[model samples]
Target: MAEIDHIVLGARSLEEGAAFVERHLGIRPRPGGQHLGFGTHNMLLGLGRGVYLEVIAPDPAQPDPPRARPFDLDDPALRQALEAEPRLIAWVARTPVLEAVIARLGHRGGEVVAMTRGDLSWRMAFPPQRQDMDNLIPALIQWQGEGASSRLPDSHARLLQLEGEHPEVDAVRAALAERGLEEALKLRPGPHARLVARLRRADGVEVALASG
Candidate 1:
């Protein structure tokens, strides 16, 4: 029953990411809730139909816990990634069954990690190391249902179907089918991370924001 809930623009700074979005799409994003445990914060733009887009970066103001950071922000590679270019580093999709999705998701980099990121109670099943960023996919989620995003009004932005240039796109679809995942979320595993969102702006012109 779940589809693509959001796209994430993994940036080094919150303002930089939001500005990139505003310049490209001509819409200002609103401040989303904070994830103190994740060591990150985000600004949000409604993508209509209960979906959204996020501009995320490490929150330097948060207290540094004695233990390791919860989200991927602490990872040096991700840090360097933003330093190089604040672009679409990764995106997450919601799954009804957390454990089941983890099992089926063909992440070549070992098992997924079960970690809590503040108010967001979810797990990030990414590559164990930084080198796998090229092949690393998305974090499947089973959100902590608390009406956090339930009451938000979504600005209707039409999402056109996705197109993939990778050869393994069929395999990816077949794998999802094997796992009982939906076909509505068209994704193709590729070398570079980019968000290909086909949406109509408020002015009724169809455009795709490469920012994710």
Candidate 2:
């Protein structure tokens, strides 16, 4: 069965996003390398167990690529949204047999692209267009070797639950159900698409991370 892998937080800059996690969640994420072709980079924080948090942003050091960046960072609306602060933009579901899952879903999930960051590598099924499904549905992932969560230092923050709001709640639920992930993700009818993550700190304090 597919399982929640990680949540993606988008920011204008990696420094800003990492700072937000440290200040608000009381955890400092470790440096994750650049996405060569995508012109983006990330910082990662372990959410305990096999789940983690990924804060991604544009890599200023890299020259603009021919193609648009992932997570719809190049979109004007998304840029405006991030002007104030970083926001939860997407999430990933992990499955051992990614191809099978994609086939079962009739390829609505996206295309599987092999990606690498330093020693870490994985295959991600991204939507045809960056905003095709966006926050309404999750991308599929299959780790090439060991998952990043296993190597990350525990940040003392545990993921409680993940929920979302989408105008097409029924379609989203259907997709998740097809992937056998319906029970792991909760969706409600709403005007716009948004993802919410609930987490608890070691001190027993709970915090919610939402997409704006």
Candidate 3:
């Protein structure tokens, strides 16, 4: 099955997004690796297993980053909304069939691209979009090549669940399918339609979904 590799946080700017997470979780995120193709960079936190939390924003310094514009930078309301409500943007999965996934996405009226930061030298694949954001869809990523940093500190916020609203739920599911992500993941929402994630930390036990 396609294992969830990360939970993405999309934002117009890193300065803002980083600050938001820190304020809520009371933990500052460190500067993460870069994505040359998508013109993106992020900060990361290990949630569990290989799964991580990535706060992604467009990087202007990249020379060959994607030609995408980025998120709703022009909309003042969008920025304000994000500053007030920094919810989970999406979730990613790791698959052995990276090429096959890319091909399927390309065929299904979507584009896929991979990027590597020269400074840190790590690679990640993402969903194609005109802007840096992909219509609230999870960007698929596959770790490639060598020198990848699996470093993460345990005993942090445990994500017990991640639930999407009515229309958004359907949209995300379809997007994953269009990008060729079925059969590898059992991500279907049940009658409760809640993403139940069990998180255990020194603080106490917590849950993300209601019925979990």
Candidate 4:
């Protein structure tokens, strides 16, 4: 079965993203190494139970990549949005039966592509069009060794719920069900598409992080 692996928070810079997380969740994320080919880097905060929050931004130290970066980081509109604040852009689902899942879903589930950062490695189903159901449809990932969440500093936060609104809610739900992720998130119909994640902090305060 597929389950939430991590949530993606996009930012204008790593520092900005870290600050945003600290401001809301009261915990500063630890540095996550650079994505060499993707021209990005991140910081991570554990959310307990093999789940974490990922703050990702373009790496100024890396040269321009040959292709677009993941999570639409190179998109002009998304960059403008990030200028305002870090946004909860997307979430990723982990599953051991990645190849089997891909075979069943075909192109609808995107293509499996390998990714690496320092000693970490994994393969993920990258969106075929650089976007996946308004980022509400999570990318499927399969870790090579230990999962990234296990290495993150425990922030004592726990994900309570993940919800999203989309115009094509039924189709999205069908796709998620096909991938064994129907129960990972809750969905409803709306004019515009967006994602929201509810998390409980160490001190027992509940916070909601939303994507616009």
Clashing pairs in 4: none
Residue 109 error for model 1, in Å? 9.2
Q: What are the runs in model 2 whose C-alpha is more than 4 Å off? A: 130-133
Residues 38-85, candidate 1: write the lDDT tens digits: 567788787776567778887788776544543366678767766866
lDDT ranking, high to low: 4, 2, 1, 3
Q: How well does model 4 score by local distance difference test?
A: 0.90
Model 2, 73: alpha-carbon shift in Å? 1.5
Error of 4 at 66 (Å): 1.4
User: What lDDT, from 0 to 1, does candidate 1 have?
Assistant: 0.59
lDDT of 4 by residue, 17-129 (tens): 99999999999999998999889999999999799999999999999988889888998999999989999998999999898988887887787888998889999986566
TM-score of each: 0.71, 0.94, 0.65, 0.97
lDDT of 3 at 107: 41
lDDT of each: 0.59, 0.85, 0.53, 0.90
C-alpha lDDT of candidate 3 relative to the true structure: 0.53
The C-alpha stretches of model 4 lying farther than 4 A from their native spots are none
- Index of the highest-lDDT prediction: 4
